[model samples]
Target: MQQSNAYIITFSIILTVILGLLLSGTSQVLGPLQRKAEELDTRKQILGAVVDGETLRKMKANEVLEYYQNRISSIVVDIEGNKIETAPDGSPMVAEKVNVGKNYKMPAEKRVFPVFIYHAEGNPDAVESYILPVYGAGLWDEIWGYVALKTDLNTIAGVTFAHKGETPGLGARITSSDVQARYQGKEIFDETGTLQAVAMQKGEGKDYDADKHKVDGMSGATITANGVNNMVKNYLQYYSAFLEKTKSAKSSDVVALN
Candidate 1:
């Protein structure tokens, strides 16, 4: 039996409409869950810079959120290192909400940097570390990370890196624990107080143990290594003013104690 052309067209249109409605309904139902998951992931990444990944992986999502809420406080600073309570457009500024990737597209002077402060477990007044977020271009795409500095504001406590796209087992190793561990305790400032930032040298299997500003390079991933080096150097430079201010305040405190 041959179907009439009008009947076939109407049937096709109804089917298309039904499928569209189903997709729309699914999106509406899952939207909040998806957003919640992304928020959790972001918090995890930020915490990963201060806490070890092994420990983070062992905890549940709610546990992670609770830990973050209890241990971390944050502030936003401009290019000049002034603490900003509001954004340029008069909106309240939240450190965790600042999009570093979006700020990367804006002019440097117009950008706001977010600083995450990790507090000692029992003492809120005692700051254990300051975690700064950095974003930059990788060999294949965008890369970013959180770098935690010790109380001295010079030594790296830990780092957590991520990327949009990169070759598997090559440049992608930037997220590996071994690679991140290499940055621990590395100094970003020289003896003269000049910000040197940490650098990942070419190749691997060399002893950078004695050097305060050098880390082991990724094997066969020179471009990615260079990207990491530049990202660290550039973001450190961007945060130099804030770092110096913090160092000065610490020195004053020491002097007062003496």
Candidate 2:
């Protein structure tokens, strides 16, 4: 009987070791593929922020990269309007010092690649806009997205939100098409030029004075939607300087050449 018991215990130990080995090997093999999937998803979100209507449906990962390559000019600028680096090839680079605020010097390859998309057949001297990336925590997990602004830098051209985990039908609505559409053409600032991040309120008819810069919150999804609003407002503050510089540069070009 004791010999039989000993055999059972040994078998259990071997099984556990085998399972562990299998899991570890699987993780190693799938890591690169998983990363590729994430990169593709990010590219899709960035493209989605800029396009409208059926154009979004037609966009694929390769198409996104191609469009960005043809239209977007990437540059790394300091908090003070000085150019730290510029990618002549327009290849996207990982933003390493993103969270370091505006104090640190962004490395040549580590700078945030701000994609500037020009309006089709629009004024050649017009400063179209820029899309900036934002990432932060939500109630259940991490959320990330892009916010595109007009040349005025006070208006929202478009926005796209995505999350790692959230309760479906509740917090996950942050990324829903209906929810994202609400932000389109929304002004981030008021007529007086004050930055007022739109909020997520509950129930009907909240006072969103046109001069105050506010939007109606998502019904039944207040917390998650508020998370979206806060993330945009906070991160955008960091780019205020960069926005001003871009506007000035565009103005100078308009005056000198045109």
Candidate 3:
């Protein structure tokens, strides 16, 4: 039996409306859950810079959140490194909630950078390390990470990285534990007091001297490595003012003690 054109058209329209409503209802039900999962993963990555990846992986979701809440403190700063409590629209700015990828699209001077301070366990007053977020272009998509610095603010204590799309064995290795460990104990400043960000040289299997500001290059991932180098260098430069101010305050304290 052949259906009338009007009947077919009405049926199609009704089906489309039903499908749209179903999708909207699903989104409403899952939206908060999805957001919570993303927030948890972000916290994990940020903490990974200072803590062991294995430790993070072993913990439950609530444990991770508890650890972050107890030990981590953060602040948002502009390119000039001045603390910014309110966003451009006058809303309160939360450091953990700042989207680095979105900020990367805006002009550098207009972007707000988030700095995470890892406090000593059970002692919030004592500072342990500082973690800075970095983002940049990768070979196929975007890459980003958190870099933790020691008390001096020049030594890289640890790092944790992730990418949107990269080759499995090549560029994707940026997230590998071995690759991240290479940055441990690396110095970001030279003896001349200049901020010379640590770099990943070209090619792999080449040893770099410990005293130099370079790390082992990744095999078949030169572009990704370069992106990491540039991202770290640029973000460090952006955060230099805050670093300098912190250093000055430490110096003043030392003088007062003397």
Candidate 4:
């Protein structure tokens, strides 16, 4: 016997409801783990500044977390370089708790930036380098990555860039090792101490270190190249306040020792 239209309608409705409920339940069950995975991926990207990609990709999840928790030191600071230990509401402010994706939504002055200090291999207390999270507009969408600075804070050790939807083999080349390698040994400050963040002009890096502010730009991706230049310059200026303060303190200690 064929079912009536009424019966079919009722069955369809019930089936839809059951599937909806099941999907919702599954999402709820997997939500925490999904978020945890995403956070670890972000950590991996941040670690790209110091750790090579090949090693990062081969590491296990718990190993990555253990390495980050032990070898890395994180701190949150305002745009002015002041460390923030308490939120305005009196709650604890922790660097690991900062959501940089969300924090980017805030205004420039209100933004809370996170700095990751990667300690030396055998010295947990000595910072081998500093990593700063950087984000900005790209030719097609948002671009971001981590920039690592040497202990002097003037030399750029390395950079790792990623984009939302940049064209493959073109703008996406920003993530390529060949492109990122152009930043190595480049200084962000001039001899006179003025901030001169690296510039990406095609083929200009043959003269690398000549200007102290230039890097080899990606071929055939001028817009993305300009975006990178601005991203580095603006973010470097924002982080400079903090580096200057730290540099001054170190100078004072040396003076006392002398």
lDDT, each prediction: 0.93, 0.65, 0.92, 0.86
For model 3, how does the per-residue alpha-carbon lDDT over 38-149 read when each residue is reduced to its tens digit?
A: 9999999999999998888999999999999999999999887789999878999999989999999899998999999999877766989999999998899999999999
List where candidate 2 sits over 4 angstroms from the true fold.
1-9, 77-82, 86-127, 204-212
Which candidate wins on TM-score? 3
Q: Cα deviation in Å at residue 36, candidate 3?
A: 1.0
Error of 1 at 210 (Å): 1.5
1 against 3, candidate with superior lDDT = 1
Q: Ten-residue segment with the worst summed lDDT in candidate 4?
A: 203-212
For model 3, the superposed segments whose C-alpha errors exceed 4 Å read 1-19, 209-211
Instruction: Tell me how far the alpha carbon of residue 12 in candidate 2 is from the true structure, in angstroms, after superposition.
Output: 4.7
| RMSD per model, one decimal | 2.6, 5.2, 2.2, 3.2
Better of 3 and 4 by lDDT: 3
What is the TM-score ranking, best to worst? Answer: 3, 1, 4, 2
lDDT of 2 by residue, 73-118 (tens): 4455544545555344655343432333232244423434344454
Between prediction 2 and prediction 4, the one with superior lDDT is 4
> How close is every model to the real structure, measured as TM-score?
0.90, 0.76, 0.91, 0.85
Score candidate 2 by lDDT: 0.65
Write candidate 4's Cα lDDT for 1-258 as tens digits. Answer: 899999999999999999999999999999999999988988887787888778888999999988888788888888889888887789988776776667778888998888888996547569889999888889999898889999899998888998999999999999887788778888999989999988899643365656667887777898999998888888898898889987898799889999
- Weakest 10 consecutive residues, lDDT, candidate 3? 203-212
Model 3 lDDT at residue 15: 100
Candidate 4 regions off by >4 Å?
1-26, 121-124, 203-211
